[model samples]
Target: MNTWQQAALAAEIENQAQVPVLSLAASASVRPSRRLGRPTLIQMGSNIYEQVRCISAIVRSYHWRGVIAIYEDDAYGGNAEMLTLFSEALQRVGSEIEYHLSLPPISSLSDPRESVYQELLKLLSTQSRVFIVLQSSLPMATHLFQEARRMDFMGKDSAWIITDSISSFLDSMDTSVIPYMEGALGIKSYYSKSNRPFLEFSAQFQKNFKSENPEENNTQPGIHALRADDSIAVIARALERLASDDTNTPKMMLKNILARNFSGLSGNIIFEGGDLSNSNSLLFRIINVVRTGYKELDFWTQDLDNPFRREGRDKNSSRNTTKVLDGPVIWPGYLIKRVPKGWEMPTDAKPLKIGIPAKTSFDKFVKVDEAEAEADKRYSGFCIDIFREVLKILEQNYSLPYEFHPVIGTYDELVDFVYNKVITPISSL
Candidate 1:
């Protein structure tokens, strides 16, 4: 049942039985195919496309040029489609996915902690410090962050952003896991909790939940539960509308459901193309994980021309020009008021080897002095002076350790050496 194929089969069977199907699967892969004509299955979850757009905007606001993707490898094809959509969104924001790490689905993994540790080790060799997590289960996510903290991957120079799949269920996780996920950012579907109807339902839900399960400590309902309630409300309204029609067919029921547009427990319930429409009412909130729980930082909505700004703040606020969130964030390791650079060189990284041609027709432009000790070889010329000056300027901001080596080869051969990784790079001098 975790796979999209199985879900599709179940929907098809229900369709044959003349029953209207409303799926809670939030992934794009589970969406009904349009080529077959009218959709027999309707999704009642939030749109995955909107989630991707919100994440992309956050990355752009922070000016992150590259990021690493971590996602579940499942037979459902949901995470795979999510990854593709994220990659495309990042490109539109002048960013690219440097690498993608795939973890086995939680259902398939016997030792999730060890598996996550192995994957985290692979990321240590990479330079990208910004990571985007998509379509991860609670168990897998818990282990992943625990391993990340143990390996020092949760540092001042690291930034982690998780989509709603895991974020929506953070309340259900044990308190011990929240510490491991400190400094992580999450995009969660937004709903108004202050409304009278939601408040009443929450109180009733807590009362029934405690009575049903005495052992459970966290009795509050998560986004999934709220959406489930909204889904039921939608069905009830659709059935009532169907009662007016003489023919109460499954198709007619579906039509009535799609026509619904009203505020519910999870937000406005509106359908477009057999899925929740990405309208103004459909909004996502950004959160930063802290010691107690997580703090709401900002909201992303289709209604705003500039979605990065905080709610009720001026759209032209100067802070909005640079910072995405209004509140200060505590980075990993309890570092206060420090923003991660989102990249770092490995501790064991070697000095860059710069190759220089030993023989050149134009000595003024490029010249190399041979020495018995290869390390003692001297490179000097107009080009060498310019390269040295450029390095000096770069060293002010970065630690660029490099060494020059004289190479005995034609210009073409020297270029080939650099291309084949024989040398880190080559300069004319």
Candidate 2:
């Protein structure tokens, strides 16, 4: 059949598929934890006008004038719209904007050290004013900060403004400077839905899958447990429309979703101007390092009346632009800081043996030789690859002499190993 006919048949087949609906979804089976988790999820995005306002406020407040935004030189980074808004805003109060440069994403940089650093030095020499970084990757931010610190680029003259791309722990403490990255500010997002529309979504989600949950446990799955919820949410709406309408049109469903508002567990998502790619976004602010972490100062939401960030206004002067929180806009820096109290690497660079759960959803997904199920690959499979990345990062960045050596151990074997050796000293430490 033709392409349209093929899509039509697939849509029909999806409806006929025996997959359980979200309303009658089955409970997720739990497996034993084989290794300790050092989890930090980082999602990246582009700069919107709201981000511009919030970050600009913090930067200009520090008495520094002018800006030099070194972004990833791609459609995602060197956005002309965002650059114009930021540059214009910076110039509003007579602040001099020295430069706005877009570098390649770290993923594409074949020669990150020489090429990235050389271009950075060029910006440093030519456009050394106020630094505004817009890298979409955390590793790239770390590299830049590390290089800048090694080059002794911190002082009264050189100021920086970054985003949530860098950790707050690194921001305030200035482990590179060992004292602080004082005066440097940025924007970060860290609000649970429960804090706002959180309870509403939780209540509905619990209702939707309440029957599937084991009655005895009497508890909803954790936030982590809801990781699969996104994929389900996207597919669920499609299935529901297909089931209810019997038309099973993707374009129509897409139209319906865009016409209305969607309040997800993350936040309210709205599609505007037919850009299904989710272009316009909310903005947040990082005030200053409070203690050993970066704190969120404010937010500039798309909604004018949102009290989350600051008082924003529409032409009508109807909604309250600023959201007034329970307390002053303050974010505890440790919120995003690395917490490795008992997990710190020692001087000897000991390879802290980690017992892998020999056959986990994570591990089973990585056995390349075996023919894998689509669901297994789609859901549980990325764990091993993720674990490898973590190990690689630890080996590359931390005090470890060698890589984080991974050893295979079963559930019972891991339990015994932890009980006899690993658990004892760590508990005391």
Candidate 3:
């Protein structure tokens, strides 16, 4: 039932039966052609595009230039659209997806642990340490992170950012799996807990939930549960409005439901184009996973134009101009305060070899003095000085390991050496 195919089939069956479908979990963007000029399915959940915008803002805030995308592979084209959305979102923030690692649904694999371990091994070969997980279920995400931690992928230089798919259900996950995913960041739909209706509902829900499922430890309802309550509220309101009219056709009910707008448990319940509109009231909470659970770092709202502003912060304050998170984050592994660079060099990577001409007419531009001891050879010139200074500046921010090698060849030979991969690109005077 997690796949789009199953959801589509369910929707089709409901449409044929002339029943209105209110989905609380599915957020796939259905094509207009499939709707046939009228929509049968009304998604009460938050929009995926809005989630993408929040994630883009986080990437910008961290200054990560590239990230690897890890997502569940779906055969029914649902994940394809997700990848396209993520790619476009990252591009808008001056970042791009460096690699896409598709994991099969955990149910499809015979040995999920081995499968995840093999996948993590493939990622170790790449330089991108920043990972964005999309469309992953709780079980799959837990196993993936467990394998990642086992393989040392959750080190200080690494970062993991998860979308709402897994974040929404973090409360229900087993506490044993949390250690593997500590220091990860996630975004989930926000709701007002202080509201009277929600507070009363939460109290009643806990009592009923514990009574029905005694073995379950966490009785707190998640975002989907809140949305389900709101969905029912929406239908009840629509039915009340239609009580005056004798004719309550499916189309009429749909119209009435779409026309009604009010504040509900999951924020402003407003529908446009058969889905929840991206309104200012709809907010996403940014969370950082700690040893004891996750902490709310900040909130992202459309009203602020995608910045991660703190709750109750002044709207007109000039100090909040930058799109930065308000609190410090416990980054991956041992680095609690230091931010990850989002990438790292491979352990076996060789130092960059810069080839310089052995003989030059203008010693001022390029000169190489060969000593009796080959190891004592001296290299000096305006270009070498400039290169040394540039390396010094770069080393201040990056660990750029490089060495100079004098090549006994003409200018043409040096160019050929670069073209043939024999030497790295050389800067000319």
Candidate 4:
């Protein structure tokens, strides 16, 4: 199926018609039926469980209580379901989504980049700076991020976490879009490239694939391709175990497949509960994008406690398991230190009112020129000048709004007013 939702719906329809189906697609296992002999799913895509664990670990490490979620619209079939899984993962770690936004499919929108910018602006209007993006393809991710950079949303205070569906194909992404993706953190499927079996399969597959499709030149086989080959092997092996004369029913074939085990190009091919067995082979790698491309910052497996260890180091030592990265990450704005706090005050908060002493003995230092005949009034003093300078400095970091309010009382009265009230009081003695 072309879309995740369509694939799932097709499976359900085939099941109702009593036709057994074995699905080899990315989003088929997004929400699988637990009932036996319904549809056997051979996942050739990213698993939602591992994604949940990896992203939750990063969010917890940063101590972010809330974030905004942006995803492709459900017209793509499985986007909504993926978002549900994301929300559940955040809730499990005592964190939550502050807001969730949906972007229309690229084909449906006249200008997808403009759509992304509008949605991104809505995200910026909120207090949350941390964003979790769920997309099905690399190009769509590039489109969204390019717009984010244009809006100045990709800054030192911003944090972006992307799922495997988008990140797995980073090596093949267009170079023009790579600059906009710098400082982004992504989760991707992992396999040991150094393994002899994997290397042998990769070489042969690349050679054979090029020979068969000469016109489709300069192509490289990705994880999905390897999984496709393995999926066929699994079905073929299951067919071999079936009796030559026995009926090839869907249920019978599923039983035979589940009972068998084999090794494939990427890793061991096994299934549990209609999905791939998530053991050592169901691994994930977290990467940070830089000017050059991306670098592996952390590795995670089902059995590892210390997921973030220095590269080339095999075992854990004394580092805290909860710390997400092995070393410092280069954030947006080329910052190499200081983790972002993930949220800021919205632009709608009330302005600060600074109470100033109007009736003061020192007119040069503090003076409030009040128009007795009219409602207009003005204030000027050395203290007022200093306050304005400090506010200017704060403008660089914060969107603070403040104004000096002339107090019609003595310094002691102003002090008493500030003591009883919440407004900040200033004086020039």
Candidate 5:
């Protein structure tokens, strides 16, 4: 970990620490002492069917059939359930999957001497051009890029695509690879879908909690500590109903999670079987790296056509559009772009160094406490899982390119890179 500071959203959330926090870490030292009685739910909001359709269309349109290097065997396996659905759609257009190689995890590939890169070398040996990177972590994904660079893989017309899972990794990625990975593209789940529903939720959230803060300059509105706030919304609503039903037991909570169909602020809340699906995810376009923060790219994903604007959010208003709500809003600490052109670094101050968070913040809905006996309450996040489906859907139905990768660099390293001109600034564009 490195020295760190909070973004506008982080500050917003810190102002309201009384609210329940979302947990997403996979470590023994980080689990909470108190156990949550609620069972974890797999998030399913994105549209995967549409994504698969989009990629199939792109493959057919290009008339190119090359090898596709997939990542692990989890929900994102090379030939998993989603691929089966995608293959059916692809078969219609005379295009088929050439190869399905699952890249090893980041932990396994940390050792250059490790055999993980060997499989990639074999896959690339077949001279595959149009590769689909499906690993969620960019560090692992970068391993393939490193192999390609080692093999001199980039050229004037080479094209690669990734899923939304690795898009966030680009935010704090190493800029040295920008020239090598510039043409790399990504499929996004939610870009600026932080519109009215999201804003509306934030407003109501603040109104309910009296300790809200004013909006800041060069920032957007959000509460901290909440993952996407979509999960919180779903849980909040479910709790509302459960309170009415007067059922607060673990089995009852699990039953509620399994039996109910929820409408969250993010979208229609759903699980594996319901009409809701991460498979229904959207697609956004990523071009260049915004410094070290999040990748600021053009929003190509399908968003609500009717976006609501904050009534008193005008620049003239003392409190234009920004407010701290239930928790911390996850703002891009390191954007792809640098500081504004007219602004200069503080005088007599050395270039700011990036630092790791003092306390690790959990952005997952998955539970991490191992001592808790409730197996249903153990693993807490499906947001990423849903994101996986969403991007998959984009590839399946929308013909948009969805790539994947691993998160390699240390959190501190990313912060330093961001402040030191490693990436670019974030943009709504």
Candidate 6:
């Protein structure tokens, strides 16, 4: 069997019609894995959906209605599938993408036209304040954030969200990149730090690895090592099961291995068909970049509505049991004690054109007085009164130069208008 770092190796193995293969890394795309059959090929590690919830939750927290995605363009195992899943996750959280920018692989970074720095310049000029960066390279991310810093795009009103790929890499990242990443947030895989099994396994691995590599400076085990450990354990278990049944082919052994659930250094291990147990089953840690380094800000789970939870966490505690972030966050530009608004009015800003549904049946709920000919139509109703109070609340933080516009349409149209951004919903006044 041949081994390689590239995720495309799994697909390549199938093209050769070789023996059954297994991927310790999650980067293996499910599409190709399924084509090879569940028993023939299996991928171990968290899927995209598990990681995206954390990112979507951050956008939802700021009440950002739109976001721009900047992802790496790689055919083997890249951001295309991740972007699709992430966009869906955002939609589920009542947010939509404003734009998607693709950056070529790091190998192509030397080319000026494909440089991420050039792309960052374009992103700087855009109106979307929230960005989801799904690049797999830490060096590219460093360059990206450095350019953003130079462009003054890292501000209190703007947000930069990263995925686990970059998050895990930050642990050993260069200190030079830290300053550029200030006020940035990241969504990374969360392994229970308090889990005794994991802690013990990590310590043992570190000691053994140090002994194995005497000259190596850093002996810290990464996600790959954990995956490798799980893979070895899986193979050993399969070997034991193989001793009992001579008729069980390699495919059958692979099937038995996929069905087996156990605990490992990474945490609980299980496979659902060729994928992990649950696409949304993974947990993520939310972090913010600071002058010193990154700090733990919150936690995110599958519950999209209440995804972020505060620290002082218990590993065994459920997501529903956790709270929001503990204290004030230090935003970009060294600003302390404020959350980014995630948006701003355009230069050609206009009054918030509020869409009020016109109704004949429930006239008291929303009566559009067409008799009063005015630039902004007159509206009086119990519903209008409720909306007015919400406007007052909004005015405290933002300018509420709003004008009521009556829409002679069905309830569906009113919703569609809001969804299409034709008019702001008065319900969100």
Selected candidate, larger TM-score, 1 vs 6 = 1
TM-score of 6: 0.71
Error of 3 at 190 (Å): 1.0
Give one digit per residue, the lDDT tens place, for model 6 in 226-294: 767888888788778878987667666776687777877666777765655543344777787787667
Question: Quick one: ranking by lDDT, best first?
Answer: 3, 1, 4, 6, 2, 5
Ten consecutive residues with minimal summed lDDT in candidate 5? 25-34
Overlapping backbone residue pairs in candidate 3 total 0
- What tens digits encode model 3's per-residue C-alpha lDDT throughout 319-400? 2323567668887885767688888753326566677787788899878876635632377789988988998998786677
Kindly indicate the candidate among 3 and 4 with the higher lDDT: 3
lDDT per prediction? 0.75, 0.44, 0.76, 0.69, 0.41, 0.67
List the RMSD of every prediction in angstroms: 4.3, 25.6, 5.2, 8.5, 24.9, 6.7
**Which model is ahead, 4 or 5, in terms of lDDT?**
4
TM-score of each: 0.84, 0.47, 0.82, 0.73, 0.47, 0.71
The better-scoring model by TM-score among 1 and 5 is: 1
For model 1, residues 344-405, the per-residue Cα lDDT tens digits are 75233656667778788898877887653564336778988888899899888878777777
Q: How many residue pairs collide in each prediction?
A: 0, 12, 0, 1, 79, 1
Give me candidate 3's TM-score against the actual structure. 0.82
Give stretches of model 3 more than 4 Å off.
Answer: 1-5, 16-18, 26-38, 212-217, 241-243, 303-306, 316-323, 350-429
TM-score of 2: 0.47
Candidate 4, residues 1-429: lDDT per residue as tens digits? Answer: 545455556666777554435554455344364542446444445566567667877887788888888877758456656667778878877788888888877778788777777777777556678888865456567888888888877777788888776776665455556778888888877776777877787788768877876665334556666677777787788788776737767777777777667767656767777666665633777788887778888776654344444547655442344565865787766767788778764344545556777788888887787765442236677877777789789889888765557777677878777545545444432
lDDT of 2 by residue, 333-408 (tens): 2222221121123345344543334345554554432254562343234555786668687877665433221224
Candidate 6 residues lying further than 4 Å off, grouped into runs, are 1-9, 15-18, 27-32, 35-39, 76-80, 111-114, 195-197, 204-219, 243-249, 279-282, 309-324, 344-429
Which of 2 and 5 is the better model by lDDT?
2
Off by over 4 Å in 2: 1-47, 75-78, 124-128, 164-183, 193-235, 275-283, 287-292, 300-429
